[model samples]
Target chain A: MKELSLNILDIVENSTKAKAELVEIEIIEDKTTLTVRITDDGSGMSEETLLSVTDPFYTTRTTRKVGMGIPLFRLAAEQTGGSLTITSHHIDDYPEEHGTVVNASFDKSHIDFTPLGDIVSTITTLIQGHPDVDFKFTHTVDDSSVSLDTRELREVLDDIPLDNFEVLLWIKDNLIEQYNKIKYK
Target chain B: MKSLAELQAIKERMKNKIVLREGTGDIRVVVGMATCGIAAGARPVLAAFVEEVSNAGLNDKVTVSQTGCVGYCQLEPIVEIYEAGKDKVTYIHMTADKAKEVVEKHLKGGKIVAEYTVTDDN
Candidate 1:
């Protein structure tokens, strides 16, 4: 579960670095099923790159790929009696193009929600810090659901940058605050 | 829920003092923050730069920026230093402590710490 969140952080960082205008993250947790799906509108990879992504030693990134991120995600899902799948396409909805959707699933009954809040906080803070990027997060716990659209916050800012350190800290704190509101007693 | 008014106060304070001017500086410290960089502890290195610079009131003369990759995967937590008119100095296996020293000696005292620089051999 911990590695799962770390992988999500790494993948989301890639999305933002790709200059993605919009990024979507969905987490569904139920007693019997746990699923995490992250989609990005950033630059997609080629077929060759896609095949190499799962290899712990192969990565298109120039820096140390640690190449273990996606593999770790796959292992977490498989160990918990689930599977991981990925689909990539271009900007025009063509399968031959470049965008990516990585979906990993696990047995919810065996997972822990303690770390879920951290995952959400990481995403929210990254988005808040990088105001140039927009993030849409939808989280579901069994049947209860919550969604946060940064676009609305963007409207409040009139599209100005939210890179101020204090503002970014507030965003991170608020995400933790909101998560505690919904998850903890 | 913080608003632009708070940012305005920051801007006002910044206007009264010197601020960062991108791409035109005597020294530029670029931290590699791609996936590998993060895994290898680039975030702390980067954060230390910000903290140390702001603490020393050199945020104007020193600029810290993040770059995706420098094609040096083996050197994950790499930092590149470029002075006003000197050659680019690449430092490998950087820790937050070493970064602080770079700021003090190289940046403040104007001496190139060659031991930390990327060279043929240690």
Candidate 2:
């Protein structure tokens, strides 16, 4: 992916495929480091699956020979002298608390650091595609932060779908307004 | 800043429209959105479809969504359109611009853009 936002989208897609009902995406930008942490309450992976998740050749899919989501994400972070870490608890093992967490940290000073492009679009796209699923998104840069939680919107909208075009547009505009507040980073 | 008050107003406006759409059939526009598709630029394609469908005021009659890997890596960024009681039309290797045309032609005009559809080779 050309942008880190695209990688975020790809990883979250994996979460949804695993039957996650809630996904939380957090981006924290510090002085010289950038970190993206995605947590999902999905059917987590097995030990075998978790071990080979970063391997481009290993995939649960029988149709194709490779799965590139985690692998590419790892590459993107490593290219900037950063690292990617994933932890999961399968339902078979931890039935009460089964989910996955993906944390990738990057050295923003590195020349190869990828930019975060059009996160507003990513957020809106995720909501538009999966209106039933809930998402919590937060981006923190310096002293400024922006956040949105669908649960709140759900409380407000009793019968309306989250994918309603006007609602999605409102979300996009809200995100834009929030990003505009993060003037420094 | 976006406030809940504005959303409340939008909800009020949408109430009548929602009731009118209750019993009618809705078309489905599904886009491939796996790693291959994202790498091939399906994000923009999906976004374009959403915006175009909204702009054309077809939200009541159409729904746009995404799918996992289509298993055809070479045909990344594929899009499929399904109408009730009809065969699904699969469009391959789509871009943002192509998504708009597909919306206008196949979606709105009730005519398929055959050239963009997959054939035996594709």
Give per-residue CA lDDT, model 2, range B1-122, as digits (tens). Answer: 68999998889998879989887646999998888888899999999999999898888889898988879879879999999988999999899999999999999999999999999986
DockQ of the two-chain complex in candidate 2: 0.77
lDDT over C-alpha atoms for residue A84 of model 1: 89
Q: For model 1, which pairs clash?
A: A44-A98, A89-A97, A90-A97, A90-A98
Candidate 2 colliding pairs: none
| Model 2 lDDT, residue B112, Cα | 97
How high is each candidate's interface RMSD, in Å? 4.8, 1.0
For candidate 1, please provide the TM-score of chain A on its own: 0.81
Model 1 ranges with Cα > 4 A deviation: A1-3, A17-19, A29-34, A45-52, A56-58, A61-69, A92-98, A107-131, A138-149, A158-160, A180-185, B1-26, B71-74, B96-119
Candidate 1 falls in which docking quality class?
incorrect
Q: Against the true structure, what is every candidate's RMSD?
A: 4.8, 1.4
Report lDDT (Cα) of residue B84, candidate 2. Answer: 92
Number of clashes found in candidate 2: 0
Q: Alpha-carbon error at B85 in model 2, in Å?
A: 3.7
How much is A37 displaced in model 2, in angstroms? 0.3
